[model samples]
Target: MKLTRIAQLGAVAAVAALTLTACAANEGGSTAPTSSESQAAALSGNLVGQGASSQQVAIQAWTAAFNQTNPDAVVEYDPAGSGTGRESFLAGAVNFAGSDRAFKVDEIAKGGFGACAADSGIVEIPAYVSPIAIIFNVPGVKSLNLDAATVSGIFAGTITKWNDPAIAADNKDATLPDLAINPVHRSDKSGTTANFTDYLSANAKDVWTWGSVEEWPAGVVGEAAEKTSGVVEAVKAGEGSIGYADSSQAAGIASVKVKVGSEFVEHSPEGAAIALDASKIEDGRTDGDLAFAIDRTTTASGAYPVFLVSYLIGCEQYKDENVAALTKAFFQTAVSEEGQSSAAKNAGSAPISDDLRTQSLAAIDLIK
Candidate 1:
């Protein structure tokens, strides 16, 4: 469950500069440490997490806020790909892991999360939810609207030219030059790729032949890059290039407004949040675990289907007591209203709903 609410900046690209709330002292002048101080005092030593480069901006905000309250708590999170993060967590290299996709049933059954106690159930909590913008660098095309079928064709390598009628039909007013279209993709194992492909497969199954996968499939033609940043950079360097990335990183590029049913919708924090609200948890995932099954066939007029629901995964019971305690505290601050606000300010992400907050807090309580 995610309690965090992601909000607006500009075109969902200008992350509104976050203003810090002043911490006023208590009126009683009690020497007793206030709640914030006590939380800080309660936490000491380092906590580490690794995964999902898309969550880097949010992690920075969450960690900074955590450190202010608990100066002694040194939390370090490495923005490695989701595959690396999951590998590290299962190998006991990190106390917690952040991933765009939740653990599969087979993975949960394997029982190799080295940090967990012998019989501890995995706690998969949905923390960050945001839109993955379809960013492009096409000359004279400030805004191009493409429907799912056309998008699938371009990414699938069937639509090679920018001025192709299939694309031109979508953006009739935009002067799409007769240039070769280069589709940049993530070469590395990435959750972003998984979600992006999932959207394609769901909305345009006939055109997007390659099904949803973390790694790009065989015979799929595209300029492959290492990670989210690499994909963006690759697209930026090439003329008439297009790539998909988290909306936060798409500041300089022209993001496409995707056609969802009758209307083309721009990516916004509220737009993304509405999609999540309409989604449901996956089947067989009960108790404290949360793995969202986003319906990519969403007809929610303004909601964006290319959204990522990032998860912060940990063990219900840890082998090291301190790891469990520290992990719990870090996440507690992560989903709090202040923590959610920090994410919005830094990443332009939508905040999680209130019911999700309650379920997430309940899940956190299980981290014994």
Candidate 2:
């Protein structure tokens, strides 16, 4: 996905003139409310956000819908990786940040947000939920069954060939290729990498020694690519190559069915929701911070454990009231039912449940 920048900071007369008519009134007559009294009062301003290439498609959808209501709101976002987004947000280079993972408890404790007033808290809302696909490219082989250990061994560079006994054992029906197995990984620091590594570290700790990390471990060897698209391209170009990425971008690539208890499960919006329902919010977070601790080791039926919960990170209090209003309004739009449906249609992401949406909106309301 390319950088998404939508600048619609000009007023529409029809939207600005919108007013609410009072229905419950005396026999005198119904009266139209003033612009200030109308609940649909339009907002106008520019908002800049950076981070999480995984959210590029969803952001595009969101900005488009946000403009329908707030036509004068300028929304610009750069799909720079997640790490850069967090750093930029902390530095006050952008109004908000999008990250696959929320800031750690220690990082929040430090509390020096440049965009916020002194001693203000931060708000992190899980607005996007998606499954990470294990995509592969092997000639004459479009599908294969992969378990945690076999996947860990392949990515860890322990299993070099496609016809290895471990791989062959799970895929007895498919023809095992004798070609070399090439694994591709993200070169940059990424939340997707964090989620992928978390799953491996939890289920395949014996083979994958490294714990959950945003950066690829130095000792682990593989073909390195810059972002999600780069990894997809690398796997597409290389024969017998495999990589993990957001399911939306893994459309053309052959995906693996990961083992979940007694059955092999494929990645989908429903499957991702199942995995998300099994997760819990992290402890030690403020009411405005809805950071999730995903249950990556889940074996529940129809659950796709390798999923990511992308967050929209912002300050609970901004230095400027206009900036605060714009940020809060945009976040409200993002977590709204309409916004979630738009994302589901455009990005193939699972819509957050009604309960989660209500919680997210309440958190966004805390912004000032």
Candidate 3:
């Protein structure tokens, strides 16, 4: 996995008006002559997408850029959690779905993508990337270094105190008080939950016996919050509180340095991109599906394993050409360099590498 220096690929601040002036500038949608030209020729329609609150910021940027070019287009994207988005898609209630986790094999086998033909295929494209940062609000502590076991144990309810020996062992030099440790978790079904739990389940199996499931383990010990905002607020409102969220939301909180390989690594766009680069396409997918199976157990020196490859999923063939054309156009735009830069600017996300973006555009072409 090759990584571009985060310094060189820094994100630009995403603004609707600015994106509009860029001609409303730029999608796979890359093979086209140009984004402006292609988007200008798009048909007028309304598209509604639901899912993946994690991608909400990126979606805002993408839609802003999209609407700038296709003025007739109306897009309403609900920041519902991934599960709800998938349910809405499968139920035929939404035009498309934004998800952190792609459709499972069994789900694809059900042949239930609502907008497509009975036996049509589906397409999954990875459009957004970010590190899952563990944020904290402990008084007097500006930073923390933690291993998988200690973190898992804390959320698992095995470690209750902020100054537990396990935690202190990882940070022997830091001053720690004997205050109670409060771990905040998402109450809604979330892709972020799935990634965080997957990491714990992969590295701290003994302590995280509940395994990796989207919703926090039933009855798990932690303050339950509704979404990213709720989780962030919950952590901020309490002392000795720790919560995990996309690094884009790391406005005023201290973040954790997680154990990765032999060294504790701080989250960065380059690190997150390395982990994403290490991912492999999931097996048993149709020829056109672009879903990835991220390996959260990676021990690469700079790769942050706890990461998400958010996706925009749609039918291989929509029943309506207008829907199909609009979906294809928007997806193409979202996967383009400008679209990715917008997301990075707005979400503190790492832009997809050119190789992955090229592959994604090729896959986008399959969205007939």
Can you write out model 2's per-residue Cα lDDT over 251-303, one digit (the tens) per residue?
A: 97899999999899988989999999999999888999999988988888999
lDDT score of residue 159 within candidate 2: 95
lDDT per residue for candidate 3 within 109-159, as digits (tens), equals: 878778676788888899988898899888889888999999899899999
By summed lDDT, the worst window of 10 consecutive residues in model 2 runs over: 13-22
lDDT of 1 by residue, 185-282 (tens): 98888999999999999999999978889989978888888878998898889888999998878876888888887999888888888888789998
Q: How many clashes show up in model 2? A: 0
lDDT of each: 0.81, 0.86, 0.82
Per-model TM values vs. the true structure: 0.91, 0.91, 0.91
Estimate the Cα RMSD of every predicted model relative to the unseen true structure. Answer: 5.5, 5.9, 6.2
Alpha-carbon error at 162 in model 3, in Å?
0.8
Q: Report the lDDT of model 2 for residue 34.
A: 24
Q: Candidate 3 has what TM-score? A: 0.91
